[model samples]
Target: MDIELLRDYCLAKPAVEECFPFGPDNLVFKVNGKMFLLASIDQQPLQFNVKCDPEKAIELREQYPSILPGYHMNKKLWNTVIIDGSLSTQQLKEFIDHSYELVIKGKKK
Candidate 1:
């Protein structure tokens, strides 16, 4: 998937907004002012970082080479996913949805 598609998908969620809070190189998507996903705009091969359950994070890293510990993020709770054509679009969207849901769930508590 491309950055536009990824941006659109994230923006489609309720209360979601995009910003460059970490400078122009990083595009961050947030819900209720809390970040759920982040993309490095200046990078190649389209990749993004998303929040994930600690256990599931490890599980995914083991199952998919494109999925790695979040670069420069909390390794236990985040994942850096590469859109290298190794995974389907549906799977990528699922990652975004999971992160979005997790942020919303946290806001409720």
Candidate 2:
């Protein structure tokens, strides 16, 4: 999916909002005021970083080589998923949903 589609998908979820808290190029998607997804709007290789369980993170990276430890995030707590590769759009949506739920379940800052 492209940027707008990805943005719309996350924004459609409960209590979600979009912002550029890091800068103009970086787009952040948050739920309940906590960010769960982020990407560089100006970057290539369309992918969005998301929070993930540490064990599941390694499993995903192994299962889908396209999935990697998150860029600029704690490797143990997050992952950067390459959305346009290996996974289908449906699977990608599920991953996004999972990330949203995981963040909401995390300790609030």
Candidate 3:
């Protein structure tokens, strides 16, 4: 999995939108106007940062070297996943779902 994979996954979701809200090289994926996924096109190893539950983020980091605190996001609430095939596609998809849900849950009320 890489930037293209991330893009495809996000775009496949209903009402999802892709943007460069952070910059040209950085891609942002949103659903219902809320961000759930973000990745840098130029970054090496094709890493992506996703909104995630703080506890889950820590667990993932402990379980896989590919998962770490997001570079530009809240360290306690997000994670950076290296797209190196370390995690199974199913697992990646699940993480994406969790990330999306977490972001949606955090929307202004």
Candidate 4:
């Protein structure tokens, strides 16, 4: 998914907000002040990082080459998904949902 699509998806989540806390190149999506997704605006083919369960993270990386260890993030708990048409739009939305849910769940701890 592209930046705008990703932005809309994230903002649709409850109490979600978008900001460039790291810099202009990175678009960060946070829920209740905790980050769940980070998209690089300066990259081609587009890519974004999403929080994921450790085991599921590895499983995704193994299942899809477009999905890899998170860039500049804790690899065990995050993933970098390349928007290269290999994954459907629905799948991308699921990734965003999972990330948002994970962040919200973590907030309770």
Candidate 5:
């Protein structure tokens, strides 16, 4: 999905908000004031980092070329996903959903 679509999708979720905490080039989506996903607006092919379960994160990287260790993030808990047309739009949404849910779950603890 493109940046606009991604922004809209994230905003549609409950209690979600977008901000440029790191700078104008990086768009961060947060739930309950905690970041879940971050998109580098200045990058080509559209890449985003999302929080993921450590084990699942490694599994995804192994299963998909477009998914990799999160750029400039904690590799164990995050993943950098490249929108290189190898994955479906639904898959992208799932990644965001997983991240969002993980953050929400964290808030409960």
Candidate 6:
């Protein structure tokens, strides 16, 4: 999906807010004041980093070349997903949901 679609998807989730705290190039999505997703607005091929279960993150990286260790993030807990048509929109949305859920879960702790 494109940036607008991704933005809409994340905003559709409960209590999600988009911000440019890291600067205009980096768009961040937060839930309950915790960041769960970060995308570079100026980047080509459209990529976003999402929080993920550590083991699952490895699995996804192994499964898809487009999924890699999060850029400038804790690689063990996040995955940078490239939106290059390799993944379906549903799959991307699921990733966003997982990221949001992970943030919410973290906030509870």
Candidate that scores best on lDDT = 5
Residues 1-109, candidate 3: write the lDDT tens digits: 7667778888898778999988899988888788888888998878888888788789889999989899888899889888787888888888889988777777745
lDDT of each: 0.96, 0.87, 0.85, 0.94, 0.97, 0.94
Better of 2 and 4 by TM-score: 4
For 1-109, candidate 5 gives per-residue lDDT tens digits of: 8999999999999999999999999999999999999999889999999999999999999999999999999999999999989999999999999999999999999
Per-residue lDDT over 2-62 for candidate 4, one digit per residue giving the tens place of the 0 to 100 score = 8888888889888988999999999999999999999998899899999999999999999
Model 1 over residues 1-108: C-alpha lDDT tens digits?
999999999999999999999999999999999999999987889999999999999999999999999999999999999999999999999999999999999999
As for lDDT, the candidate ahead, 1 or 3, is: 1
True-vs-predicted CA distance for residue 98, candidate 1, Å? 0.3
- How much is 56 displaced in model 1, in angstroms? 0.6
Clashing pairs in 5: none
Runs of candidate 5 exceeding 4 Å displacement: none
Candidate 3: stretches off by over 4 Å: none
Question: Which 10-residue window of candidate 1 scores lowest in summed lDDT?
Answer: 38-47
Residue-level lDDT tens digits of model 2 in 9-96: 9999989999999999999998888899998787777888988888999999899988998999989988888865678989788889
Q: Would you list the clashing residue pairs of candidate 6? A: none
**Clash list (residue pairs), candidate 3:** none
lDDT measured at residue 69 in model 5 versus the true structure, 0 to 100: 100
Error of 6 at 8 (Å): 0.5
- Model 5 worst lDDT run, 10 consecutive residues: 37-46
Clashes of 4: 0
Residue 38 in model 2: shift from native, Å? 0.3
Better of 3 and 4 by lDDT: 4
Residue 102, candidate 2: Cα error in Å is 0.8
